[model samples]
Target: MLQYLTVPVTAFAQNCSIVWCDQTMDAAIIDPGGDLDRLLVEVKRLHLNLQAIWLTHAHIDHAGGTAELAERLQLPIIGPHPGDQFWIDGLAQQSQMFGFPHADPFTPTRWLQDGDSVQIGQSTLAVRHCPGHTPGHVVFHSAEAQRAFVGDVLFAGGIGRTDFPQGNHQQLLDSIKERLWPMGDATVFIPGHGPESTFGHERRFNPYVGTP
Candidate 1:
């Protein structure tokens, strides 16, 4: 079985998930957004081999702790080439600007792209480029588990704000309508913040999506 743990890290209180395959002890971390200590503790407790770090976007709250976790665990950081290169390069400045404590930048070990497949434990995540929150924003889909980690794209009852530099409301809406909505009602939606929701729940009740 593949196990999942969500660790709320950093001052942003982003959810960083520790996903592992019980049989292999192989694991992948999704959005190690902050608080290196908490992530490390969970990794140790589970006796998981940190194989890869996956990012949902380039925002400081989502990718801030990536460098630290990668360096400490000697794991590779992988994510799509953000459409918002400015945000990716300016993570440190963004942190300072937002008063979200300080974080250092480190080059991504690998650039994620649309349709990319990342193997973690016994599962494979199909990368779906879902931008607007940040240029390179994406949602990782695991078909077997019927789950998608949609970072800052579509929240439970609302949607991600596109007020930041490079953020675009239209694009985000399009992304949600075109990419996420097609995932079907049964797909579990795990957003970057707040409680989880199903695609059906969002479609039927999410104020942003509205009734079809």
Candidate 2:
């Protein structure tokens, strides 16, 4: 079985999830944005053996601390696809502009694509390349548990902002309606920020993508 916890980090309160296997205790840290100390504390407290650092996108608030944490732990970094390299390359600038902690860019040890599978202990998560909010954005879904960790691609009662350089308003909607909806209405999604919601709830009420 897979077990997880949402650890909010940074001033943005990005939800950095620590997902692990119940049996082996092997774990992955998903989107460790900024609060390195908090994340480390959680890892130690949980007695988890860090296997990999997973990213959903390269936005500063969602991935600002990835490089540092991964380097310090000597863990492999994975996912977020490869298209968000530009955003990854600008981490230092983002940190300065946003008054974030020192953030440096690092390459993903493995660049995931749509249909990729990520294994944490005995559980596996499917990768969906749901871009638009960011070109390389992806959502990690555990089909067994009907749960997803969707970065900025989605949220409760709202959608990701498309004002950024590579953001596309239309594409974001498509990702939610097309890529995410098929996961099943009961699929609960954990967004980059804020509370969690199911696809069914979002489809019926989310002002941006729900029916009129």
Candidate 3:
């Protein structure tokens, strides 16, 4: 079985998740935006073997610590798709703009596509290219666990803002209605910031994209 813990990191309070396969104890950190020391301590406390760094997008609050973490742990940096290359390239500038610590730009070890899958020990997560908040944003879904790490794509009562560079409102909406909704309304999602919510709840109550 797959298990995860959400740790809020950085000034942005981004939800950095530590997901691991219970049977193997192999773990992957999703969106190590910042505060490496704190995240590392949690990893140790949990007695998990850190394996990789998975990204949902290249926004400063979501990917600021990616490069440094990957280098220090010698872990593979994966996902967020190729569309976010420009955002990845501007990590340093983003850090300065957001008043975050200097963030180094990085290249993903493997660029993910919509239909790809990522493995962490005995567990496997399906990758969905969910762009809108950023051109290359993606979400990780664990079917067996019935959970989705949706990054900034969707939220408790709101949806991701499409005001950034390369952001497309229609495309984002489409990704949610098509890629996400199909995952089943009962699935619980972890957003980049704030609390978690179920797709069924969002579909019935979300103001921006709710069916109700």
lDDT of 1 by residue, 8-72 (tens): 77777787888887778999989887887878788999899889998888788888877777887
Candidate ranking under lDDT, highest first, comes to: 3, 2, 1
lDDT of 3 at 111: 89
Worst 10-residue lDDT window, candidate 3 = 203-212
Tens-digit per-residue lDDT, 1-212, candidate 3: 99999999999899999999999999999999999999999999999999999999999998999999999989999988999999999999999999999999988999899989999999999999998888999999999999999999999999899998999999999999999999999999999999999999999999988988
Q: Is candidate 1 or candidate 3 better by TM-score?
A: 3
User: How do the residues 1-212 of candidate 2 rate in per-residue lDDT, one tens digit apiece?
Assistant: 88899999989999999999999999999999988898889988999999999999998998898998888889999978998999999999989999998799998999999999999999999999998999999999999988999998889989999999889999989988889999999999999999999999999999899974
Best by lDDT: 3
Candidate ranking (TM-score, best to worst): 3, 2, 1
Instruction: Please report the TM-score between candidate 1 and the true structure.
Output: 0.94
RMSD of 1: 1.4
Q: C-alpha displacement of 65 in model 3, angstroms? A: 0.6
Model 2 lDDT-worst window of ten: 203-212
TM-scores, all candidates, are 0.94, 0.98, 0.99
After superposing candidate 1 on the true structure, give the runs of residues whose Cα lies further than 4 Å from its correct spot. none
